[model samples]
Target chain A: MTDLLPSPPPATRRPAPPGALSIGWARVALELRLFVRDPGQLVFSFAYPVVMLVIFGSIFADREVAPGVDFRQYFLAGIAATGIMLTSFQAVGLAITEERDRGDLVRLQTLGTPPLAYGIGKAGQVVLTTAVQLTVLLVVAATVYDVPMPDDAGRWLTFAWVAVLGVLAGTVLGIAVSSFVGSARAAGTGIPAVAIVLQFFSGVFFVFSELPGWMQQLAAVFPLKWMTQGMRSVFLPDAAKAAEPAGSWEHGTTAAVLAAWVIIGVVVCARSFRWRRNAG
Target chain B: MTTTHGAPALPAAASGERPAVQVRGLVKRYGGRAVVDGVDLDVRRGEVFALLGPNGAGKTTTVEILAGLRRRDGGSLEVLGEDPAGADRRWRDRVGVVGQSTGAGDALTVRETVDHYARYHATPQDSAELLDAVGLEGTARTRVDRLSGGQRRRLEVALGVQGRPELLFLDEPTTGLDPAARRQFWTLIEGLRDRGTTVLLTTHYLDEAAHLADRVGVIAGGRLVEVAAPGALGAGLRQEATVRWTEDGAAREVVTREPSAVLRDLLAAAPTGEIPDLSVTRPGLEDVYLRLVSEGASR
Candidate 1:
């Protein structure tokens, strides 16, 4: 059993680095710069939430609903939820889908960009956006409305976990939706359309308790309701729990519901991720 | 350049032991129809091989399969000594793929895009230098959205070669480029050849193939009908010369083997010793390509 065959030549290029940090971070830096180039987009995504808070504050000015609490204080938690969903789900979904339709994702595929790096970069963007988004909502609620800022360490700790979980829910849901929304035109209209509808159920503009039974059930199935409840746990006073749909912030249910969504979104995104438009 | 009729075109030949690419009985099916029906090809190291075909002749499909961007139904294919289907980031770093119409990162400046892409490679060419090489240095600060179609294609070329890949897959690289830019692209391709990079380009421009490719593969009906050096492709069926002349104020056509002798006889018969409105023609690579494709299609 003697065989003789010529071996191939050695490859000319050097071995690639272990991870995609160098490449992915470069993409992030480039996208960050691109984000700044369009002043309108920056203002719309980051500043619009504050504008929304002002409108809500003006409409609900100082009613003294819960001893010292007004309608604006009760409304603060819901608005914070809306801001999270807006940036993490709506903004990320639209941006990623646009990139996919325009073949930017495909281009990244050919350039040896590790698949996860794209996800990480996109998630990083959403995380960064949600930070600014939440900051503005908190600022307006505290400054204009004279809402109490939590000095208690336990309350602040609760706020931190809730925000992190809420952001995860939003970012993952955005990625999953990008798969379901195929073309640029559909993505452009579909994402915001879904957001507007979600707002009605999630109680961003009105009290979640006031919504009909069917609407409450529908809203409970989504992360936005849980996000709103979690924010209520952090911002609203103890007695304000009377207004919640579940008769309290339902902190345990808030953690379970958002965590469930995180798992579902990760599963859907795994199955639906398209490397190319024509790819089955 | 005086290679034998059967010899592969040596566009700054490489002395490497491995061929840049090899495929055997490659097949791809779309629903029921086999778009790439059993193709076999070999491109030597450092050779500029052009796959010339019509729109649906599966040139792009075959390139996609070789780039590992698509899966084949059945085939044994290799690029840079590895199966493209199983290629990793390391494998991708050693290659490049440019599509016919690519759109991405339109909001970034030319310099930013180039610099960003170069990060994927271990030791990529300098972004400024790559832009300069592709004639995009002047537009380095220009937004990609503002670049002309031709200019954007140049930027793609710059990005494609930034890795200094061992093999480059260009699917209609010059489609949107102007004539001057096309000439510049050819020069850039030649520079890649000097660096021992093997290029597999699919193009509709046969003249582009003729000018740049060391060898041309005319693919039609999902198969390669002919593969040869551009000069040798139509040498056989060429009934030699295509003679045209103005006879009694009307254009006339004839085919013959001995064009020089025919012209001399025409001059001898003419009283003016000048054959008015006469021209001699010979079959080119394009003629061979058309005949090969047409004949294949008819079959």
Candidate 2:
């Protein structure tokens, strides 16, 4: 049947796909470049948390959860956790919604972009930007608020895993929610509202021990609570552990919850992501 | 219902020619109403085929199904030797699509956007050459959001062809362009055709189809009313000429199969050698197209 037509030229023969890894890196580079070009997004993702930390850190400077464990240090940890979520969840959610609305995702799909590569590209942007945001937050906390860095290698290691897992979980969840959003405008307000409410529930803006027992239980079911606790474990003094709701840093639970979210978010994102708005 | 004489019979797959695209009984439904009722079409390799229709006429829907961007309720279809429903990345690599409403990433500059799309195909066209061909070289450094609508469209075309696909789908590609830019865009499509790319373009403009398509399909009311060479469409109607003349202080007109005979009779009746305000003209493609569309709608 194929022989009925004259043979097309050699170049017309189907070409093998450009390798997935290469495509993924290309997407990552492009996403990063775009992220940098949008000054509004840059300032919101990187600067908002730093600004919040300074304003709140100063208000609670002298209060201590325990002797030698300043309340400002505890607030610093929560602000850093929130910064990771801002960069990963909020940034990714808003970008995906806008892309879908603008038909950009449909354009990419038509070009035969590997779906995995596209996901990797978004996640890569989240990771890189979250890293930068985290660095700025940490630097500000240390220099301005006089919050000390994690002195031990183990504490630093904890910080690394928590941040990585928090970002991954947030990135995938962001993508998953992006599909359900009706438009970029909806996502702009909706995603941040969800983030802020989670912050309140997860004790980012309040002391976990002081929150109502039901709110603490409710917060335990979500990842942000674990992420905040994990951040506190790394940055706060060892004596501050007594002030935790569990009376100690629940490192094991934090790891399990964040990792589980990463897995669950990936599944949800894969199922929910759409190339076009209002697509069947 | 008004299939033209030049329309091909549904040939077997092993027949004389392997068409780049073939559809039979294509159907798409929205809330139980068939937006694309039943569409049958064929586009041979290395030829430019245009689908002409009015708004809500299913042109975009049909093209979307062909491009694998939308699903059909029922149909037997083939594009680039594969069913778009089951088409994979390999099939996609060979088929380029410039969707009617879909657009590229707006945050990236024109060159970067082109470069990004090029990475999806194994062998892509040179970015500089593509930009120049689409008349976007001067604006390559400008962010896509900053581009004028026509420039953005030119950029869309640049991305669509960057992959050098065997088949290209352009949906209303010249909708917003100035006449000069539209002509330039037509030239670029001609160049692609010269390189053996089979193009399936959809447009409401008769002149665009008449100028570029080797064959034009007139679709209306979710059905293909006719498929013929631009000049040959509604040929039977075009054969009859309309003759008009002034007589007895009134304008008189007659529709006839032979304008010469009518002119002869009118001249003989006139006392003067010259008939007053006389004209004999046949229907152009535009008239035929409008007639076809209106007829298709009524049916």
Candidate 3:
């Protein structure tokens, strides 16, 4: 049969694929560009944290936690934690759900995009945006509210490790949550609401040691509480450690909990991430 | 002709015989009902094969299975010489799919979207050249969300072929296009055909099947009724021409194999050499397709 028909002109040999890393990097660039283009997402992800910081910082301008640390300075660390969650977990969940609903993920799947590469692209975008978001929050704190930057190298290092782990845990959890959501609209409302409620429980709006015993125990189980605790350790002085529930920063527990969540979130993401909302 | 389950196997010339796609007893069911029931088909490489069927006749389901987008409940199938269900990135790189609806995201510009997807393939057509090929060069800078429906579909085609796939599956590519856009789309597909891309398209429109397909497979009731060249469909029906003429102010019609012989008798009986309103017409593919579909419906 086919032999009887004139054969097609020989296909030219194609170059080997640039490999998954390059494709993943390309996706990162594209995702970032799109993120910048959507003003709604931009304001929500970047501005929400900055605005919260300013509002809380202004309200407590005259109040002081100790000899030098103002209440606004203490609140700034919690706001930064919230910012990380906003950009990584909440924003990522919403983006994935909407993209899945829109069929973009399915299109990429058909295009031979490795799921790892897609995840990399998504994680990269969150990392970049979250960095910018935290910078803006810090700038507002340092310049406007007379809040000092971390003076020592150790504090800066703690900030770096905590930020990386928080973002990683949040991003993976976001993707995993997207797989469970049935529609973009549901994710849109549900993810942000979940983020806000977690903040209340995790002591973002109040000092952690002052919260009720049951609330403290429940908050300790979640990543956001660990993230807020980690951020506070970086911003506050050694004397402030006495105000923690354990009378110390509990750096080991913070690191262990965040790392555990990262592991759990990765496992959940690998098992649950879907290319389409209705995927079987 | 209405149903061909477990159809006769193609003769073995096992060596050097590779169809672009081959399926045996393909079956896909939802709950208790089979949407695609025991379909067997072969699409030769580099030919445009159209699976023509009415809405919900399983054309899309069959095409989706062959494209590896959907799973089959039971079957043995090969696409581009690989089992699609287990096909890897390498296999996907050789296949392109233009789905029934547009899946291109609106956030990126037309050129960016094309270039973005092009990165997925080892060898991709140039984004600028592909846009030009699809007659969308002018709209390259336009945001995808802003493009008109027809333009959006053309961009979808550009994205589909940017991978330079050897086998392309188009599921009802022109379902909603206006006449002019549909013709323009046909020309684009024709260009791809000239480039030797093996195309498998599913369409409910008979004229589209006739215009674009080298061979059309009329499928109904989740089964292929017949697979033949458009002109060769419904062999028995094609032989019988419907002859009509006005006699004594009454219209008379007869179905016959030889329209010329019937005309000769009419000519001899008429005192005047003119046969009023005489018309001899064989059933077109559309008629044959409708008749075949009706038979499938009844069964």
Indicate the residue-level lDDT of A189 in model 2.
96
Model 1 agreement with the true structure over A42-114: per-residue lDDT tens digits: 8987788788778878877866556666778767877888888887888778887878877787787777678
Ranking by lDDT: 2, 3, 1
lDDT of 3 by residue, B7-87 (tens): 344333256758888888889998879888888898988899999999999998898788877778887787877778877
lDDT, candidate 3, A1-280, per-residue tens: 1111112223446555567788889989998999999999889888888788878877877887766677887888898998998889998898888888878887876776778888899899999999999898898788987788888999999999999999999999998899887799999889889888899989898877778999999989999998999998988888988888889888999999999999999999888876866552
lDDT digits (tens) for residues B1-299 of candidate 1: 12223323333325656577877778899998888988889899889999988889989999988887888887677677777777778888778888776666777889878877767777577776677677777999998999988888877777777776778899999886789979877887887776677889999788998999999988887898888888777667666779999888888887888888888888888858566779988876667778888886555
What residue runs in model 2 are displaced by over 4 Å at the alpha carbon? A1-13, B1-11, B243-279
Clashing pairs in 3: none
Quote model 2's TM-score. 0.92
Lowest-sum lDDT 10-residue window in model 2 chain A = A1-10
TM per prediction: 0.88, 0.92, 0.90
Per-residue error (Å), model 3, residue B202: 1.4
| Highest-scoring model, DockQ | 2
Itemize residue pairs with steric clashes in candidate 2. Answer: none
Clashes of 1: 0
Best by lDDT: 2
Please provide the root mean square deviation of candidate 3 (C-alpha atoms, Å): 4.8
